[model samples]
Target chain A: MMKPGTRLKSAVCDAEIMIIKIAESADLSCGGQLMAEAPERTEGDGDRMHGCLIGKRYVNAEETIEVLCVKSGDGSLYYEGQELMTKDTKKLPSSD
Target chain B: MNIALLLQMAAEACPDRCALTHEGRHYTFSELFAAAQRAAHHFLAAEVKFVALMDVSSPAVPIALMGAAMSGVPYAPINYRLSEAQLTPLLDRISPAYLITGSEIVAEDRSGWVVRSSEEFMSVVSEGEISDLAWHDDPSAVAVQLFTSGTTGEPKAALLRHEHLVSYILGSVEFMGADEAEAALVSVPPYHIAGISAVMSNIYACRHIVQLPNFDPQVWLTLCAEQSVTSAFVVPTMLSRIIETLQQGAMATEALSSIKSIAYGGGKMPVPVIEHALALLPQVNFTNAYGLTETSSTITLLDPDDHRAALEQSDGPIRARLGSVGRPLPAVEIEIRDEHGAVLPPLEAGEIYVRGPQVSGEYEGRSVLDEAGWFPTRDAGYVDDEGYLFLSGRADDVIVRGGENISPGEIEDLLHQHSAISDVAAVGVPSEEWGETIALAVVTAAGQSITEDGLREHIRNHLRSSRVPELIQFVNELPYNETGKLLRREVRAWFAAEAA
Candidate 1:
């Protein structure tokens, strides 16, 4: 089980995800491929269809997990074999 | 995950953005990242167990902090203002460590440690190549070890794990949420939790930080205007001084107009100072952040909205909520319990206990967490019906007079509202009849005086007759630590001597 604050990378592509919430027995994947523990520089041909931009957050369908892309990649994020969607931006309260 | 990952993320996302500013010098996130990497290599070469900074805030602060985190070692920042007598014991505790210090503070005997001047340390770090970009991300690894200020007693080492700090940042702050032009001015001492928290939070939010090692009201104001500092955090005493400086027209209003928000904590803010600040700086947002080092900086913040609402609202109950420490963070849980440990209802004052992912509640060896994971904060407070937590004072500071538990904060707050009183502290002194009686030490406003009879009548009319102080003495000023915490222990001693 991936825990919140855990960083996952794709061995097949440049996709990276930071886990926001740990789901029980959820299959977290990227571009139809299982995600690995660290990022790979070389791009893979598993899925070249979607792109992940830096600073954009990707979330699962149930919204139980959210990840902000700190680095851009060619592969799209997936969970339970479904493509993750961009979450609407919510204004966070200022805490200094 | 290691807390260094926060800095790594910032460097990856905005490498060119300015990460830190000090004395007109600036370093980008990329430069800071590379510098930390180099410094980590130096630490590994020196075979040091910890990277300790016994100096003031500067570029070296972030460099050493991130370097220690990257090397999987604890980073400790010791108070530079402490005298040699007080500082020697602390240095002895962190032996076999790498100490980065300023030139003037270097001691003759440097046994069991490697000491490097800040300039020498920076130059050496810059000489090395940037390697080992990936740091060990073990969540259990200790990140920063801070010494408590020891206001009431001896200082203890409070440990903050990487997971604890990371959870606090992720739960309280948004990722890359700051505007590109936004900058924060940090004046709190590096040893204080507020100083450390400001650096991590601002870096994660991508906000540029300007450090002020020695706080002067003029320098702070000047830097705010020149840097266009949008945010700042100050202790209550600093805020009081700033408010006084600004109110005296010593600094231009235009200089301070650029400040969008200011957060004050690290001590209880007197009602008069905060009210005066609100009246003077109407444009700025005011936040009251309340937390302890054991809780990783801030578990509760009276946000800007709460500040504005309390000022605008007319209802007394609603307006008085201004004095509260706001509600607990979504990730933290707080309970008020009586002496026997029974949980108290809202509006009933009792000992404050907290449990959360970020609450370390730890020292070096002994864990303060109870069987149920609750850490007794040893602070007496209550939550209003609206869930706003109001702190009375430290449990040790409470006064017991003739078997009646009385909070000194209540009396102090009431007396502070008097027009002639500038500062006041209520301490319990030995009494012959009553076991202990409250003695009030007061500082009259500039060129102003109030008779002891007049003050006694004010307290009696405002509160019950039992609440009136038995002994009231006029003093020049009350003692306070550097971080703005009242030295109640010292105050009681002073009052005792005066009575004798």
Candidate 2:
């Protein structure tokens, strides 16, 4: 989904993501397959590129498309074959 | 996405983790989630416009909060400390409501007000079977309505949408990042924004929450030890009292041995109090969170590293950072704007403006964000050359004398550095020569004495004559609200009466 706050599950792996920011019609893929809105899709093929971590955000180089990993799985998230970089968030002390 | 997404994720990932502990009753994540769903059904069945909690912190606070969010109504938490006259109109504003009380206030059948006692609320929340229900996912829907009491008219209802709160949690916290061993002690009242956000953020992080309905410093320390509370959020005054309890040997340092981090805010923290705290609890990581209800919770955080670095330095930028609220969070952008609305450069004092997804600068009917999307925070402050934010005081509280604008916080902070003064407040009194003159209220330490002229000399040594308080009134204590917010408006009213 293009809207912020929309979550998508990986078609290929168990990885789940909630969109923080994204461009319309962007080719967002994970584990070499396009992400889907829900379950009950064809099984994902190809190698399971394992790297995504729970609670980490992956963003494109332009910094426009961002997604937080709500569930981690064996998948390297990508935007048009270029791997999305895991944002290096300086873990500040929880103030709440 | 709805904040319900956070609870859903946590429940799905770790249902067995202890999510909440209140009065010795521990709830797993799944239990909290199920209770939230049941609460949602209760709200949906009641068909209320607002879900109001006229109570202090309890499991009901979170359940009602999430339930309101899931059911697409705003969760309005009213200040339980308000007088009857003050609270009546506020209560009327948010009705037709599901009013839950955790206090002695008797539940009455006001038109459309469905009153539920705290005990009733708890049982009702947890009694029903789980339902596979769908929640509203609209990002723009108002999630929370906090009634912020100003010195003027009635309290203003500040609204926070689902998007704003979710962004704050996602931006500031990692999902399921906490281990099973972690528990946070939250003592800020249920009505305070800190109390609301603390529950949401800790739930998202999968940290066990231990709510103290009433805050007693000894009780707090004892609970910290008993519950193994590794993290906590306290207002500035609470920390001082906690430190006093530790110092008095009423509670040993080992009682707080499990405390790994403590976050303090909601008022101007005196440098001396923080310094003393740091010296006493070297093992604890201290964070200074600075934000308003309008900003969702914290936009800038003085993290543990900043505290450790500042405490070790004698004098420098690092040392001065202890006086600052550190830098803005990575997702937040802060600016200082002059009276004319032009952006001021670093180190120039002006009004603080913030821009971020989490900033919900909206009241019930009006939005405060500028066209460019920056919300002008009424709090007066400046950013250092290195981007550290130093809060002078609230813009409304600034004392204007002659042509210069004076910050009362500056004078009060300087006075706090004096050993004799235990507490202080500076306000503006009407003057003929100048529009307003300074009036200081000083609370000296027990058995300590200081003359007006001596206090004036002490102020003059550190600041200009204009900055010195014109009238010094020694008092036993400064007037502070339950949340440690200094009632400067009341202090100012007292001086105005004297002038009259």
Candidate 3:
């Protein structure tokens, strides 16, 4: 199970994701494959199936889990068998 | 998590983007990250307990900061201006440290300490191959140790844990939010909290940074125009100098047009100076960020929109807002409290207290947090009906005369409005009859002269008679710390010596 602040990567694609939140019993997948620690690698043509854009955040339908795409790839992010959609970035007041 | 995660994430998102520029040299995000990784390995091999940088602004500042994070050590940037005697105790406090120094500010070498010049340190760190160094993810690790500029008392090391700094960045800044071409100019010294926070926030926002080791008005304006700098953070003194430079017509008309935003803090901003700046740079967004070393930089920001409204709109409510520090950041909670610790109502001046994840009241081994986790800022201020915070000044600077507590800030603020008064400071001296009496030190404007009674009459017209200074002394200029905080204690001492 992935948790907030966890750095993960799709075992099937080059997509990188940082988990923002997750559920008690939820499987986070990308390109129809389970997630793995960033250091681990397993190859598949997951990029050809779905695309992940750079600097975009993807959230599940229930909003229970969210991940930011640190690097763009041809893989889509999913959680609990549901594909996540891009979330609109919120403008924050500048502090510096 | 280690604070280095912010840099790592930025490098991953945009490896080719320029992360920093120093003395005409540029380092990409990926290159800086790699250097930090290798430096961490070197730090571990040397077995230093802390990573201390005792140099002016340079590429080594960012590298040392990130390397310290990767090594699970606190990054302490010592003030190079301090004398050997003054630097001894501070260096002793952080023993067994890997010190990186520039040309002539090297401290005495000791056992368990490794010292390297900036050039040597950079060359060594840059020559090695990237190591598979494991960065510690302990949230409780001390990430930064910044010594407070003790204009009033001895300097104390304010501790910021990994969680405190990281939470501050995550809550306040949007990740990868800045446009690719955006760059920020950082002129504050690395030892100040604003300088450290500016670097982290700019990197997290995916923006480039240009560091000015020493502040010069002409150089700053030239850098902004040349580098296409969109944002910058400066102290009130720096802003005042820049404004004065612009008023003298020394800067090109189009020189500062490239700057989109400018944030000023570290001291009280005179109303006149800000008004002048607003009129000069109409297109630039002016922000007043108010924070302390313990609060991870900014707790409240007078935003650019508020600046514009206060300047353009004539309504009393909107215009009065110019003197405020705006509202608290979304992640911060603020409360004004009386001496009894009871919360004060709106418009009632009291001590300003703040609570938040970013608020680290840790000093050395002591934690000053109250039972409810609130940190008393020791600042006197009142929150307006609209929640805007107006700081009166440091709580210790309050003057008690004839049983009435008067904030020097209010008196000084009013004194600044006088056309003949260029700068002013109000203090309380020992009065035989009353507990204390108000004293004013005035700096007249260029070629302008005013008598003691003339200054008193000017103040008497605006404020209550009791609030007027019983004794006024004209001076050339008031003393200020490097970051622009007024040395009120010194002023009080001067008054005492004169009375004797």
Candidate that scores best on lDDT: 2
Better of 2 and 3 by lDDT: 2
- Once fitted onto the true fold, the runs of candidate 2 whose alpha carbons sit more than 4 angstroms away are A9-15, A26-39, A48-54, A72-85, B103-107, B151-153
Q: What is candidate 1's lDDT per residue for B1-500, written digit by digit as tens?
A: 77887898899889999999999999999999889999988887778778899888888998899999998879999998888778878877777789898845557576657888888888877666677556776787889999999988888999999888987887788778898899999999888899888889998998999999999999999999999999999999999888888888999778987888898889898877888989888998888888999999888878878888898986586788778888888889999999999999999999999999899999986789999899999989999998899999999888889999999999988988888999999988989898899999899999888998999899999997888998888888889888899998888998788878
Model 1 chain B weakest lDDT span, ten residues long: B103-112
Whole-model lDDT per candidate = 0.85, 0.87, 0.85
How would the candidate models be sorted by lDDT, starting from the highest? 2, 3, 1
Q: In model 3 chain A, where is the ten-residue run with the lowest total lDDT?
A: A39-48
Worst 10 residues of 3 chain B by lDDT: B101-110
Docking class of 1: acceptable
lDDT string, candidate 2, B19-135, tens digits: 999999999888888888999999988888999998878889888898888898889998777777777788778878988985555347577668887789889888867787777
TM-score of chain A of each: 0.75, 0.83, 0.77
C-alpha displacement of B94 in model 1, angstroms? 1.4
Per-residue lDDT, model 1, residue B39, is: 90
What tens-digit string does per-residue lDDT give for candidate 3 at A1-96? 655556677777778776655555447677777776753555554443578876567887777776767667666777777788987654656667
lDDT of 2 by residue, A34-66 (tens): 887875554554564865877788988888788
Question: What order do you get sorting by TM-score, best first?
Answer: 2, 1, 3
Q: What share of the true interface contacts does each candidate keep?
A: 0.33, 0.62, 0.42
Q: What is each candidate's DockQ, to 2 decimals?
A: 0.43, 0.61, 0.42
Top-down DockQ ranking: 2, 1, 3
